[model samples]
Target: MRAWRFHEPGNIANLVLEEVDTPPLNIGEALVRLECAALNPADRYLVQGQYPRAGAPPFTPGRDGAGTVVEVGPDSRFTPGDKVCLLGGGLTGVSLPGTLAEYAPLPEAWLAPIPDAWTFEQAATTLTSLTAWRALEICGGLQSNDTVLVTGASGGVGVAAVFLAKALGARIVALSRSAEKRKNLIALGADAAIDTESSTLEKEVRAAAGDQPISLVIENLGGPYLEKSVRMVAPEGRIMVIGLLADLTATVTIGLLIHKNIRIQGMSVNNFKAKEAQDAWTKIVDLYNANHHRPPISQVFPFAQVQEAFAHLQAGPMGKVLVRCSA
Candidate 1:
């Protein structure tokens, strides 16, 4: 099988397509004939060797994929030809060969049934949506009527956060650098959209919330925004930090945090265990099937053009970029 492997991660150029032997399914695992693979920021980080996961060189770089079961171990519950999407396996682009190939071995526990309403492209993007859902619903303890702010609101995770927050009946304020993207956010059920580039995001959020401080902040960008996030959070509000796309090194004022009684947390999609991850994936699938929301597909790439798909994600987009792996 052909897979995109990192020869010695330094840049995107290090990702090379090579033919390798297909991995066999182990006990409790199944071999999936991948239909689509979703590219995440972590994929780029792994390819560039920026992530903390240690691995030998020439690893395939993808975390989430949707596919059909081609073979299953005798111990697994799934049979051949079941449509599924994989969750946490720690095999994408870092610790092991990932979904960047035509096939991948996934644990049965990590597989979620794709909703009948969703296409392979949508299912491939479910992991990020599940992460965002867990961040706001489970970890953040979001409640209906609470005002939530989502940073990086045009990106994959950000868009998911917006939709999930809305689905849970929370009032959402989406922050983005682009005006056009802000318009899209409003269409996605955001109460309001703030332009983080031109206006003071802290001020805009305060104005939108209107005497009510932001109840929860789903943050992806750090740097200056962190300081502002700390300030704008309501007393007893929770701030979930998921990604650092802006600046990682920034001085924060501890006094504000002390006075505001804010709870700031770092959230990663990989932090959840098997049972929790499986539950979250099921909830997302149910939501999609119920017509509550859907994952947005910004673009779809052929399996042969996985590199181009990664490049498109790096350029930034309104939703997840998908790479179709099945003929």
Candidate 2:
């Protein structure tokens, strides 16, 4: 099998494609012939050796993908030819021989059935959607009519968060740096879209909510925005921090936090407990199948053009970028 493996992570250039022996499926695992593999900012971190997952040289680096089962272990529930999406098995390009290759062995527990209506490209991006759904619905304690703010509202998770928040009947205020992206967010059901570049984000958000403090904040950036989010949240409002795209360190006012009684929570979709992940997957599948929401793909790249896909993502895109692993 031809796999893109990280020799010694320093840059994207380190990812080299080579023929490698395919591993046999273990008990409770199934081998999937990948059709698509989705990349995230985490992939960039992994390639740069910034991610905490320790490993020696020569490891494949994708985390989420969609494929068909070509081989299943006797103990697994899925049979060959079953369409599935994989989550949380550390089989990503960084940890194991990930979906970047033509074949991947995933634990049965991590596999979920993809809806017939969903293309392999869509299913490959399910992990990001699931993460956003989990953060807003489960961890954020989102309620109908709740006023929410989604920072980084143009990225993969942000787009999913917008759709999920809308489906839940929440009033959403999406913040983005680009006007064009803001327009897309509005179409995705954001009640209001703010250009963070020109306006005061806190004021804009507050105004959009009609002076009501934000009930929940789906935060992706974590610098000045974090401090501002702390101040903008209503009393007892939940602020779920899902990403730190901006500077990680920031000076915040403790007085504002104490006075407002805000709950600042940090969430990593990958860190969810098994039960939590199962629940999230169930909800995501339900939504996907019901046609309640769908993630927008900004672009799709062929497996050979994986580097271009990564570059486009790093340059900032309006939606998820998918790598088609199969024809």
Candidate 3:
């Protein structure tokens, strides 16, 4: 099998494509012939040896992908030719063989059947949608008619958050620096879109909020933006931290939390229980089938252009980037 193997990751250039032995199918696991794999910002961090699991190299690198089962191990629930999508490989390409290759062995628990109406590219992008759903529902506790603020609203999780928030009958104020992307967010059901580049982000958000304060904030950018989000939340409003695009460490005024009684929760798909993940998947698939949500694909690169795909994601794509693992 040919895979994008990390030798000693310092950059994407260090990820060399070479023939590697296929992983042996173990009990409770199934072998999937990948059709498409989506790249996340986490992949970039893994390449830079910034991710915790990005220790020793010589492993394949990818986390989320969609494929068909080619072989199922003993006790596995999947059957050959079953279409499936998976979310975690615990830092794949870092600690384990990942979806960047033509095939991967995934634990049955992590595999979810893909809908017939969805394409492989769409299935590959489901992890972000699931993350968004989990963030809004489980972490943020968003309710109908709730006004939610979504930062980094142009990215995969952000866009999905907008769509899911709309589907739940929640009002959304999406934030993005690009004016064009802000327009796109509005088209995707954002009640209002604020340009993050504006010096008066708080003013714009407050203006959009009118009287009712933000009931929930889906924060993607951490660091200083988190402080702003903390300030924007209504009294006792929850803020869900999904990603730290700016800085890992953040500083916020302690007085704000004490005064407003804000609730801050970190949202990670890895931390979700099986039932929670299943619930999220069900909602995402139903939304897709209802034409209420669609995974935005910014670009699709061939398997050979895996490096380019990583580079594109690192440059901050407006939507999801995918690698075509097979024809």
Candidate 4:
């Protein structure tokens, strides 16, 4: 098998595609022949040694993909030729070799059957949606009448949160730095798309929410948005911090927390337990079945151009970029 490997993890462009032996399957694991894989910003950061959860050098870097099960070890529910795809990230590409390879030995618990309505591309492009499901729906307990706010709304997880929250009957507001991307956010079901860099962001959000309060917030970073979120969030609302695209630390007003009873939490897709991860994956499939809006595809590069794929990912695409691993 040929896999992309990094020896020192300094630059994504330094990744080398080399022939390597297939990983051996363990109990409750399946060896999947990957058809396609999705590329996230984290993948490049992992290869570049910027991600906190990245494994040591000499490992493949990928989190989500869809493939066919070529074999299964003992005690696994899947058999030969079962269609499976990955959602969350923890062991894959971190402690274990990731799905970027042609074949990956993955725990059956982290793999879910691809929905019948989705193609291999659709299934592979769903990592951010699964992240949003965990962040917005499960962690935040989003309700139909709730007004949801998603910071960095043009990014993968933020875009998915807007769409998923809307599909679940919540009115959503999308915040992005790009004026053009904000237009796309409105089409994705956000009640309003506001510029994250705007001076009067809180006032704009208040207008968007109308009578309802901002009951749930999916904050993308700890920078400028953190202080504003504390002020805009309604009493007893939940704020789930899922991304730190900016600085690692931000100042917050403790008074707001004590007065409004705002609950703030930080989470990652990799942190969910088995049962909750499976449930999130199941709900994502159902949600896609209804609207089939796979995150927009910016490009799909073949395996040989793996270096180019990372470049595209770093260029800040408007949507998902992918790698076709097999013929």
Top candidate (lDDT): 3
Candidate 4 C-alpha lDDT tens digits along 1-327: 988888887767768998999988888789999999888877877877887767777888888889999998777788888898886554787667887899998878888888886777778876788788888777888889899999878777877788889889999988887778888888878889998888888999998888998989999866867888999999999999987776668889999999999999997887777777778777876776778666666678999988888777655555677899996
List residue ranges in candidate 1 displaced over 4 A.
Answer: 88-93
- Indicate which candidate wins on TM-score: 1
Query: Residues 1-327, candidate 2, lDDT per residue (tens digit)?
Result: 877888887988888878889878778788999998888888878888888764567878788899999998676788898999876434345565677888888777777887668778888886777788878887888889689999998998899888888777788999999888999999988989998665577777888889655899998888888998887788888899888888767777988888888888888776765556667777776765575566788899988998998999888778888888775
User: Would you list the clashing residue pairs of candidate 3?
Assistant: 60-93, 61-93
Of 2 and 3, the candidate ahead on lDDT is: 3
Better of 1 and 3 by TM-score: 1
Instruction: Show where candidate 4 strays beyond 4 Å.
Output: 50-53
- Please report how far candidate 3 places residue 60 from its true position, in Å: 1.2
- Cα displacement (angstroms), candidate 3, residue 154, comes to 0.6
Candidate 3 ranges beyond 4 A from true positions? 88-94
Please report how far candidate 3 places residue 159 from its true position, in Å. Answer: 0.7
Per-residue error (Å), model 4, residue 166: 0.7
Cα lDDT tens digits, model 3, 238-318, are 999989998898998889998999988887766766666767787778877787456888899999998888778767677
Give the per-residue Cα lDDT of candidate 2 at 132. Answer: 88
Count clashing residue pairs in model 4.
0
Off by over 4 Å in 2: 88-94
**What does candidate 2 score on TM?**
0.94
lDDT of 1 by residue, 1-327 (tens): 888887887988888888899987777788999989888888888877788874678688788888999998776788888998878434554586688899988777778887777777788886678779878988999899789999888899999899888888899988988888899999988999998775566777888989666899998888888887888888888889988888766667898888888898988777777788887878777766675567888899987887788788877788999888776
- Measured over all alpha carbons after superposition, the RMSD of each candidate to the real structure, in angstroms, is 1.6, 1.8, 1.7, 2.1
In model 1, what is the error at residue 252, expressed in angstroms? Answer: 1.0
Name the lDDT of candidate 2. Answer: 0.81
Model 3 scores a TM of 0.94
